[model samples]
Target: MRGKHAPRSTRWPIIILVIIAVILAPIIYGASSRNRTTKNQTTVSKKTSHSSISSSSSVKSSSTSSLSQSSSSSDVKLKSAWNTTKNKQLSAFMSQWQTEMNQTYSGTYDGQKPDYYGISFPTALENGRLSGHIKFDNQNTTVEWSPNANSSAKNQVLAVAVGQTSSNGYNRILYLFIAQEKQPKVYVSQTTNGEDLYFTETQNTALKDGFSQIYNSN
Candidate 1:
C-alpha cells in the first residue's frame, strides 16, 4: 500500500499547477476574445467612415455640375442677344440713311386687286386705291410709291434719291423694296432736285423703330 501511494507534498504541487492552469486559461481566452471584438469594431468603423466620405463627395460633385450648367446656359443666352443686336449690314446703312416718311398707307388691300392698297396722304399724284377706284384700267399699273407698309421685306431695304418726276410724283414712285444688291445704286424714282434722299438722322431713328414695330406686329 505504501509503494502504490505517492508523497503528499508531490501531489500537492501537481494540484496547485492544475489550479493555476484553470484560472489562467479563462483569463487568456477572455483577453483574446476582447481583442477580436475590438478589431471587428475598428473594421466596421473604418468602413462606415469611408462610406460617409464617398457620399459627401458625390453630393458636392452634383452641386458643382449644376452650377456649371446654369452658368453655361446664361452665357448662351447672352451670346444670342448680342448676335441679334449686332446686325452688321443693316446697322451700317441705317447709320447713314436720312429719309423721312412723307406718306402713310392705309394698307387696306383692294377687293378687286388683292396686291393694291391706298395711301393716307400722298404728296405725289396718282390714280390709285385711295381714290375708291378698285378697278385698274391698265393691267400693268405702277406701284405709285415704294416702302409701302404692305411689303414684307421692309427690314432689308434702302431707298435711292432720284429727282421728282415730271408728273410731280416721286420720279419712279413705282419702285419696289430694293434688294440688297441694288441698295447702293441710284433708284429710278430718286428725287430730280439732285438733293440727297437719305433719311435725316431723326427720320432714320424713327424708321428703324417703325420697322421694329412692324416686325413685332407680324
Candidate 2:
C-alpha cells in the first residue's frame, strides 16, 4: 500500500506562475536597457551642441579683429595722401634756399660750381621734415648739409686737421637760419671736399622766408 498524493489542481496554479515569471523576465530587462540608452544619447547631443556654439564664436571673433585692423590701415593711408599743407611748405622751403644761396653764399675762389638741390622725403609726412644733398657740379664734389647755428654742433674737427674752409665745395657751410623757421637737422654731415668746422656767424645768414630746410643732402 502507498501514501495518498496532493490534489492535482493545487499544483496547476504553481506551474502557471513559474511560466509567467520566465517569459516576463527578458521583456522587463529589455525595457530598462532601452531607457538607459535613450538617456545617454540625450547627454551626448547636449555636449555636441555646446562645442559647436563655442567654435562658431571663436571664428566670428577672429574675423572681426581682422576686419578692424584692415580698416585702421586704410584710414592712415588716406590721411597721409590728403596732407596738403606739408607739400606747399616743402616746396616754398626749397625755393627760399635756392634764392639765398644764389645771392648770399660765397665761394673760397672765383667761379665756384653751382649746387644742385634735391629733397628726401620721410615715409610719412610727419610735419614735412625732410633732408637733402647738394652736388657741386663744377668741382665734381658733393656735400650733404643742413642749416646750423651758433648752438649747432660743428665744433669737432673732421680729422683733427683744420676743418673750417672758405672753399664753396669743401666746408659745406649752411645758413645759420632759414627765414627764422624751424629747420630739419640730420644726425650726420659729410662732404667730398676738405672738412671744415662750424663756419663763423658771418658765414651763416638768415632770411625772413619763415621756413628752413631740415638736413644735409649729402
Instruction: Assess each prediction's global lDDT (C-alpha) against the native.
Output: 0.38, 0.38
TM-score of each: 0.36, 0.35
Q: What digit string (tens of lDDT, one per residue) describes model 2 on residues 5-63?
A: 84456888898999999999999999999999999999999999999999999999999
Candidate 2 has its poorest 10 consecutive residues by lDDT at 155-164
lDDT of 1 by residue, 1-218 (tens): 46867655678889999999999999999999999999999999999999999999999999999999999997764343212233333333333332233432121111111121122223232334332221122222223323322233322222312212244443333222232221211122222222212221222345445434322331
Off by over 4 Å in 2: 5-19, 82-218
Q: In candidate 1, residue 63 scores what lDDT?
A: 100
Model 1 spans with C-alpha error above 4 angstroms: 1-12, 81-218
Total clashing pairs for each candidate: 15, 9
Scored by lDDT, the top model is 1
